[model samples]
Target chain A: MEILETALMQRALIAAVLVGVIAPAVGIYLVQRRQALMGDGIGHVAMTGVGLGFLLSASPVWMATLVAIVGSIAMELIRAYGRTRGDIALAMLFYGGMAGGVLLINLSPTGSNANLSSYLFGSLSTVSEGDLDAIWVLAALVVLVTVGLRRQLFAVSQDEEFARVTGLPVRALNLLVAVTAAVTVTVAMRVVGLLLVSALMVVPVAAAQQITRSFAVTFVLSVVIGTAVTLAGTVTSYYQDVPPGATIVLLAIGVFLVLTVLATPLARRRARALRPERDEHPAAEADGPAVPAMRGPADEARV
Target chain B: MTTTQTESAGQDTNGAKDATTPTVLSLRGATATLGSRPVLRGIDVSLRRGEVVALLGANGSGKSTAVRSVIGQVPLTSGEVTLFGTPLRRFRDWARVGYVPQRTTAASGVPATVREVVSSGRLARTGLLRWPSKADRAAVQRAIDLVGLTDRAKDAVGALSGGQHQRVLIARALAAEPELLIMDEPMAGVDLASQEILAATLRDQVAAGTTVLLVLHELGPLEPLIDRAVVLRDGCVMHDGPPPKAVGQHALPGHDPELLTNQSCHPHAAGEPHRTGLLT
Candidate 1:
C-alpha cells in the first residue's frame, strides 16, 4: 500500500495495465493470422527508433513508434508483394534495425549500454511523465482500432482471399493491422521492454485458446489473463526486486502450461457429451456402407 | 445507325443464347499465367441466370485457373471478365456473389466456431462497420442449418472431421444468400454424408434460381443438379453442353442397379470406382 502511494509505482502500474490490455488485443489478430513473430520484428525495429531518440535527445517512446510503424508497413508490403523473397526481406529488416540501434546509441553524446538496456528489457521506475502521456494516447488509439473494427479485422485475419471477395478493403485493413501492431510495440516498450513485448502480445492469447472454442471467448479470456499476469508480475517485482518484464512473461507461460493441461480433460468431457449422438446412429460413424435410406430422401428432395 | 451498331456489338459479345436469360458471368479470351506457365490460354466461360454449370477437368487442366480468373483472384494477362453484365474491374456488387475457394479444412490459424466463420459471409450483405442485424443473424443460422451443422454451430471448427469442415465452408458461402455462387472443387474429398447434404443444398439453391459455377473433379452427387458441364482439357473448352454422354449415363437412368447393389463399393456415387467397375 505504501509503494502504491508513490508516484513512480502508480506510473509503473498504469503502464503495466495498459500494456496488458493493448498487447493481447492486437496480438490476438496476429496470432489468428499466424504471424505471432511479427511483434518481435516490430520490437527489433523500434530499437533503431529508440537509438535515434537518444542521438536527437528526444523522447524514445514516440521516436520508436514512428520508426516501428514504417518498418511494419514495409514488412506488410514485402509479405503482400514479395512472396518468394519475403523471409529474406524480413531477416534483413530485423537484423539491420537491431544493428542500427547499437551503432546509433554508441555514437550519441549521452547514450550508453546501460541506458539502452533499460529500453531493451524495460525499466518500470524509468517511466517518465512524458512517456506516460504518450503511452496513454497511443494505448487509446490501439484500443479504438482493435475493438471498433473487430469484425472486419477478424474477417481479414481468418481468410484474406474471402475478405477481399467480401469487398472489405483487405489491403488497407492489412496495413492497418501492421500499423496498429507497431503502435502496440511502442505502447508496451516502457513497461514490457522492446525485446520481450511480443510475449505479452502472443502468450496470453495462446494460453486462453487452450480451453476456448470461439474467437470471442478466446479474446475476452486472453485480455483477462493478460491483465491479471501483468498486475501480479508488477506487484511481485515491486516486492522481490525482479524485472517486471521477465516476471510477467514467465507468468503468462505458466498460465499457458496450466491451461494446456486442463484443456485435455475439458476436451475429453466435450467428446464424451457428443458420444451419445454417435451411438444413436452407429451406421453413420462407419465410413463403409452408404445408408440407402439417406440417399433415397436426398434424391426425392432434389426432384 | 450508331445505336444499332452498339446493340449489335453487345449481341455479338453476349452470343444468341444470352438474350432470354441474362448472363451472370462471362469471360472472353481469359488468358492467365502462373509463374510463366500458361494456366489459362484463351479460355471462355459464360453462365446465365438459374444455370448450374460445372467446370470439369483432369488435374492440371486449368479448370481452377479459369474459375479463379472469373472471380478476379488471378489476373488475366490479356482478356476481359464480366460479372452480371458488368466488367469484373468495375463490378463492385460483391454481395451478389458468394465464393467458396477449394480448401480441405475450414479451420484457420485460430479456433473459430462454425457460427463465427459463417457470420463472415453475411459481411458482404451487411457491409463493413455495421453490426449484424437480427436478419443477418437469422441468415447465418439458416446457412449453418442448410449444411446440416446446426448442432455443431457453437463448436470449434478445428474439432470437426474433414467432411464436416468442408460443410462449414459451404455453410459460410450460403450465409451471403448471393445470387451467384462460385465454388471451386466443392466435392474434392468430402465423405458420402456431407456429399449428400451439399448436393441437397445446391439443389435447393438451384431451385430458387441461384446461378452456380463450380469447378469439380467429378460430378458425383451434384450430377443431378448440373444443367451443363464445361469440360476443360489443358486450358481449352473441350466440351460444353449436356453434362457429357459418358458421364451422364452413370448418374442418370441406366446405372440404378449397379449404384444400389454396390453402394458400399461406390462410396462416392459416380467416382473412379464406379468408372473402373463399369470397365470390369
Candidate 2:
C-alpha cells in the first residue's frame, strides 16, 4: 500500500498495465504465425531506436517507435525477398539491431552506458510523463488496428496461401501486423525493458493457449493473465526492491510453466475417454451422416 | 493446332453450359516462373458456371501452379487471368470465390476449434470490423454439418487426423458458399471413407450449381461429379476433355501405356509421376 502511494510507482504500474494489455494482443498473432521470436527481434531493434534518439537529443520513446516501425517493415520485406530462410533474416535483424544500438550508445557524448542499462533492464523512475503519454497513444493505436483486422489477421496467420487465394490483402495485413508489433515492443520497453519485453509479449499468450481453444478466448485470456502478472509483479517489486522488469517476466514464465504442467494430464484424460468411442466408430466420427445420434464420452471435456 | 484442338475438346465436354453460362474463370496465355524455373507456361484454362473442372497432372507438372495462377497466388509473367468476366487485377468481389489450399504437414500451432476455423471462411462475407451475423453463423453450422464434423465443432482442429483436417478445410471453403470453389489436392491424404464423404459433399455442391476448379492427381470418389478434366504435363496443358473413363476401360488420347498400368494399382495417386500419364 505504501509503495502504491509513490508517484513513481504509480507511473510504473500504469505503464505496466498498458504494456501488459497490448503486448499479448500483438503477441497472439506472432505466436500463431510461429514467429514468437519476432517480438525479441523487434525489442532489440527498439534499443537501436532508443540509442539513435539519445544521439539526436530527441524523445527516446518516439524515436524507438519510429525505428521499430521501420525495422519491423524491413524485417517483413527481407523475409519476403531474402535469399536465405526467414529465421536467418530475423537473426540478422536481431543481432544487427543490438550491435548497432550498443555502438550508437557508446558514440553519443551526452548519455552514458547507465542510460542504456535502464532501458535494457528497466527502471521504475525512467517512465516520465511524456513516455507514459507516448505509451498510451501507441497502445490505443495497436489495440484499435488489431481489433479492426482481427479476422483478416487470424485468417492470414492460419494459412497465408489460403488467405491470399480468398482475396484478403495478405501483404498489407502482414505489414500492419509487423508495424503493430514494432510499436508494442517499443511501448513495452518502458515497463519491461528491451531485453525482457518479449517475455511480456509471448509468455502470457503461451499460458493462455494451454487453457483456451478458440483464438478469441485465447486473445482475451492472454490480456487478463498479462495484466494480473504485471500489476502483481510491479507492486511486489516495489516492496521487495527488485527490478520490476525481471519480476514481471519471471512471473509470466512461472505462470506458463504451471499451466503447461497442469494441461498435460487433463489432455491425457480427455484423450483416454475419447479413444474407445473413436475406435468403435472411426467412420461415423470422421465423415458419417451429419449430427450423429450418439456423442463421444468426452464430449463434455474442456481444455 | 493444339489450341484449336483443346478449344474444340473443351466445348465437347462443356457443351450444355458452355454456350449459355458465362466463364467464371479464364486464364489466357498465363505464364509464371517460380525462382527462375517456369512453372506454368502459356497455360490456358476456362471454367464455366455450375461446372466442376479438375486439373490433373504428375508431380511438378504445373497442376498446382495453374490453380495458383487463377487465384493470383503465382504471378503471371506473360498472360491474363479473368475472374467472373473481370480481369484479375481489378476483381475485388472475393466473397464469391472460395479457396482450400493443399494441406501442410506442419501444424499452424494455433489451437483453433473446428467451429472457429470454419467461421473464418465467412470472414470475406462478414467484411471488416463486423461480427458474424445470424446468417453467417447459420452458414458456418451448415458447412460443418456438410463435412460431417458437427460433433467436433467445438474441438481443436489439432486433435483431428490427417483425413479429418482435410475435411475441415473443405468445410471452411464451403462455408463461404462461393460461386467458384478452387481446391488444390483435396483428397491427397484423405482416407477412403472420408473421400466418399467428400465425394458426396461435392455431389451436393454440383447439384446446387457451384462452379468448381480442383487440382487432383486421380479421380477416385469425385470421378462421377467432374464434368471435365484438364491434364497438365511439365508446364503445358496436354488433355482437356471429359473425365477419363474408369482408368482402364479406354486410354486417354495422349496417355502413355505404362502409366495406365500403374494407375490401376494406385487409384488415388496424387501427383505421382507414374499416374500423370494415366489421365484417361
Candidate 3:
C-alpha cells in the first residue's frame, strides 16, 4: 500500500488496468475470427508510428495510433481483396513496419535504438502525463466500440458471409475492427510494450475458453483473467525489478496452462453427465460408414 | 414502388405470369467468374412466393455459386438481381431474407452457445446497432424450438454433432422470421437422423409459406416439398422444372453412380446462354 503514495506507481497501475480490460475485450473478436495473430501484426506496424513521433517531436502514443490505424486498414484491404500471395503481402508489411521504425528512430535528433527500445519493450515508470491522457482517450474509444457494438462485432467475427447476408455493412465493419485493433495496439504500447501487446490480447482469451462453455462467459471470464494478471504483474514489477510487460504476459500464459490442466477433468465430468443423452441418440457413430453391423468378432478384437 | 419492375420482370418469365404470386428472387443473365474461370454463365433463376425451389448440380456445376450470387456473397460480372421486386443494389429490407451458408460445422474459433449463435439471426430484424428486444428473444426461442434444439440451446455449439450443428444453423436462419430462406448444401454430410429433423423443420417452414431456395446434390427426403428444380451443369442451367425423379432408393445421391451422368430429364443444351431477356 506504501507504493500507492508514489505518482509513478499510480500511473503504471492505471495503465495496467486499462490494458487488462480492453486488450482481451478487443482480442475476443480477433480470436473468434481466427485472426489472433492480427494483433501481433498491428503491434509491428505501430513501431513506425512510435519512431515517427520521436522524429517529429510529437507524442509517440498518438503518433503510433494514427500510423497503426493506416497500417491496419491496409492489412484489412489485403485480406478482403488479395487473390493469392496475401501472406507474402502481409509479411512484407510487418517487417517493413519494424524496419521503418528502426531506421527512422536512428535518423531522429533525440531518438536512437535506445529511445525505441522503451516502446518496443515498455517503460511503465517513464509514462508521462501527456502519454497518460492520450492513453485514457484512446482506451475510452476502444471500450465504446468493443462494448457498444458487441453483438454486431460478434456476428461479423463469428461468420462474415452470414453477417453479409443479414445486410450488415460487412466491409465497413471489417474496417472498424481493423481500426479498433490498431487503437488497442497503441493503448497497450505503454504498459505491455509493442512486442508483447499481442500476448495480452490473445493469451487471456485462450485461457478463459478452456474452462468456459459459451462466448458470453468466455468474454467475461477472460477480461477478469486479464485484469487480474496485469494488476499482479504491474505490482510484482514494482518490487521485483522486472519488466511489467513481460511479467504480465507470462502471468497470462501461466493462467492458460492452469486452465488447460483443469479442463481435462472438467470435460470428462461433463461427458459423464451427458452420457445418457448421448447413448439415446448414438449420433456420434454416424460419421463412420465403413463399419457394417455384421462385422465379425475378429474385426472387433483387432480394433 | 417497385411494382412496375416486378410486373415487367414477371411477364418475361412465363412461369411467374400469375399476378397473385410475386417473384421473391429473380436472377437473369447472371454471369460471374471465380478467379480466372467462369462459375456462372448467363443463368436465369426465379422463385415465386411460398415456392420451394432447389438448385441441383454436381461438383463445380455452379449451383452453390448461383445461390451465393443471390445473397450478394459472389459478385456477378454482368447480371440483374432483384429481391422482392426491388433491384439488389437498392434493396435494403434484409429482414425478409435469411441465409444459411454451406458449412460443415457451426463452431467458430471461440466458444458460443446454441442460443447465442441462433440469436444472431435476429440481427436482421433488430438492425446492427440495437440490442435484442424481448420480441427478438422470443423469436429466437421460437426458432430454436422450431428446429427442435431447445434442449441444446444453452449448450456450447462445439459440443454438437454434425446434424445438430446444421440444426443450429437452420434455427439461426429462422430466428429472423424471414419470408425468404436461402440455404447452400444444407444436407451435405449430415447423418440420417439429423437430415430427417432438418426435413421436418423445413416442412414446417414451407407450410408456413416461407419461400425457400436451397442447393442440394440430389433430391433426397426434400423431394416431396420441392416445387421446382433448376439443375446446373458447367455454369449453365440444364433443367428448370419438376425435380428429376429418382428411380428408387438406389438412385439417391451418393448411392447411384449413374445419377450424375444421366441427362434424360434435361431439355436444354448445356453451356447455352439463357435467351429470356428478363432483368433480375
Candidate 4:
C-alpha cells in the first residue's frame, strides 16, 4: 500500500473528522443566535491572543482563548446595553472584534510574515495531537452544555422578553452563549485558522437550515454537512496539491450553494401544491385577512 | 370632573355564577419608578379566578408597568403584588402564570420559527435542566394549532407576515396553559384577523377558567371581548371596574381628563413595532 505509514496524514484525518464533528455542531447554535458572523469577528479578535502568546513565547491557543473569552464577554455586555434593541449590539461587537484582531496583528513585528496567514487561513499540517485533544475536550463540553441547557437556550433564543418576564434567568443564558462562542473560537483556532473560522461557523449550519425546519434536526444535519466538507477538503487538498484551508472553505461553499438552490425549487413546488388546501377554506374566513401582523419584512422590523 | 363623570358599583354581567369567591392576582399600593420616573404608582387592583380583566391607560400611564410588576419584571418601589395568593417576591413558581408581555417585539428578532418560539412558553414549567416531555411537545403543538399557525410553524419567524407572527407569540403563551395569562398588548399591531383569532382562542381559555390580565391603549375593538376594565394614570388607579365607567370623570380620581378626551392613548407610539436591529 502506498499509504504505508505517516504521522502527518494520520493526524490530519483524525483532526479533520474531529473538527468536522464539533465545528458545525456548535456552529448551528451560534448561527441561529445570528452570531455566525461572530465567529469571523472572534477569529479576528483572537489574533491579539495569538499575538500575545507569540510575543510572550507562550502557548498561542491559551493566549487566544483567554483574550477571546474576555472579548466575547465584553461583546455580550455591550449588546445587552441596547435596552430591547439588541441587533445594534451584535453588529457593534462583530465589527469591533474584527478590528481588534487587525490592530493586534499590526503591532506584532512578525506581522509582515506568514504567521497571520497560517493562523488566519489555517494550517492543516499544524494540527498536532495536543490540538486535537483540546478539540475533543471542547466538543464534549459543548455537547454536555447544549443538551443540559437546551431549555434555557431555547427560551432565550426564541423570546428574550417573554423569557425575562417569566423569570427564566436570561442573563445567565446570554452569558452562556458568549462563553460558548469563546470555546468555539479557541478550538477552531488550530483546525480551521482564525481568518476563515466564521465561515466554518455559519455556512454549514445555514445550509442545513434551508433543508430542515426543526432546530434539533437542523443542528444534527449541520454536523453531518460539516463533516462532509472537512473530509472532502482534506482529501482534495492531499490529492490536488491544494491549500488545505482554501480547499475546505471552497468545498463548504460548494455544498451550501447546491443545497440552497435545490431547496428553493422543492419548497416552491410544495407551496404551489398547497392551492387545494387554500381553496377548501375561503381566504377571508379561515385565512381571514385581519390586519396583517404576522408576515412581511416591514412587520419584522418594528417587532 | 372637566368632562361628564359617572359612577357605578360592582356589577356582575358574566355567567360565572360563583366567580366572585377567590382572587388569582392582587396589587396593592404598588408603584414602579423606572429611574425616578414612576411608571406605575398607587395602584390597587385585584382579580378573582376566571376574571377577564382589561387594563386601560393613556400613553406612558403605567399600564405596561402594572402588568410587568405582577410578573416580577420590574421591582415594586412600594406596595405588594401577588400571584396565586403568593407575593411576587416569594412567588417562586411563576410557571402557573403564563404571561405575554405587551411588547412581543422584545423577542421578535431571534432566529426561531413560530413553533419553536411557542414551545418556549412552557420553559418555566418544563424545569430548567431537563428535556421537554411528550406532554410538553403536545402542549406546544396544541398552542400553535390554537393560534392557527400550524401551516407556518416551520417557517422562520423572520419570514412570517405580521398577523401570523402575533399568533406565534400567542401560541408561545398558550403552550403553558397558564392559570393567569398576563398579556401586555396581545392585540396591538396585530391584524383584525389575528385579533379575532386571538379573541376566539382566549374565549376558549376563559371557558377553561383561565384568568387574563392584558394592557390596552384602546377599548373600541376589544370592548365586547373584555369582562372588566381597570384604568391607570400617573401610576395610580383612576377607574377600577369595567371599561364603560373608566372614561371621563369615572376614569378614576387622579386621571388627567385631557388624556381620555383628547390624546389617543389606546394605540400609542411605543407599542408600535419599530425596525429594531441589524439582523438584515
In terms of lDDT, the best-performing candidate is 3
Sort the candidates on TM-score, descending order.
Answer: 3, 2, 1, 4
Q: In model 1 chain A, where is the ten-residue run with the lowest total lDDT? A: A294-303
Which has the better DockQ: candidate 3, or candidate 4? 3
User: How far off is residue B116 in model 1, in Å?
Assistant: 0.3
TM-score of chain B of each: 0.81, 0.88, 0.83, 0.81
lDDT for each residue of candidate 2 in A1-303, tens digit (9 for 90 to 100)? 677787887888999899889999999999999888888988888889888988999877788889899999999888766775877778878888899888898888877789999888887677888778887899999999888788889988988877776667788899999999999988888788899988898999999889777788899989999999999888888778888899999999999999999897777667677747564444666886687688778644456
Best by DockQ: 3
- Better model by DockQ, 1 or 3? 3
Between prediction 2 and prediction 3, which has the larger DockQ? 3
| Pairs of colliding residues, candidate 1 | none
Segments in model 2 whose C-alpha atoms lie over 4 Å from true places: A85-88, A272-275, A279-303, B4-10, B13-15, B248-254, B257-280
Q: Which ten residues in a row are the worst by lDDT in model 1 chain B?
A: B258-267
Query: Taking the tens digit of each residue's C-alpha lDDT, what string does model 4 give over B26-55?
Result: 998787888756576467788888888888
When candidate 1 is compared with the true two-chain complex, its DockQ is 0.56
Question: What TM-score do all the candidates reach, one by one?
Answer: 0.88, 0.89, 0.89, 0.79
Report the lDDT tens digits of candidate 2 across residue range B208-257. 99999999888777888888888776677666777777652124433554
lDDT of each: 0.84, 0.83, 0.86, 0.72
| Candidates sorted by lDDT, best first | 3, 1, 2, 4
What is the DockQ for all candidates, taken in turn? 0.56, 0.55, 0.70, 0.34
Docking level of model 1:
medium
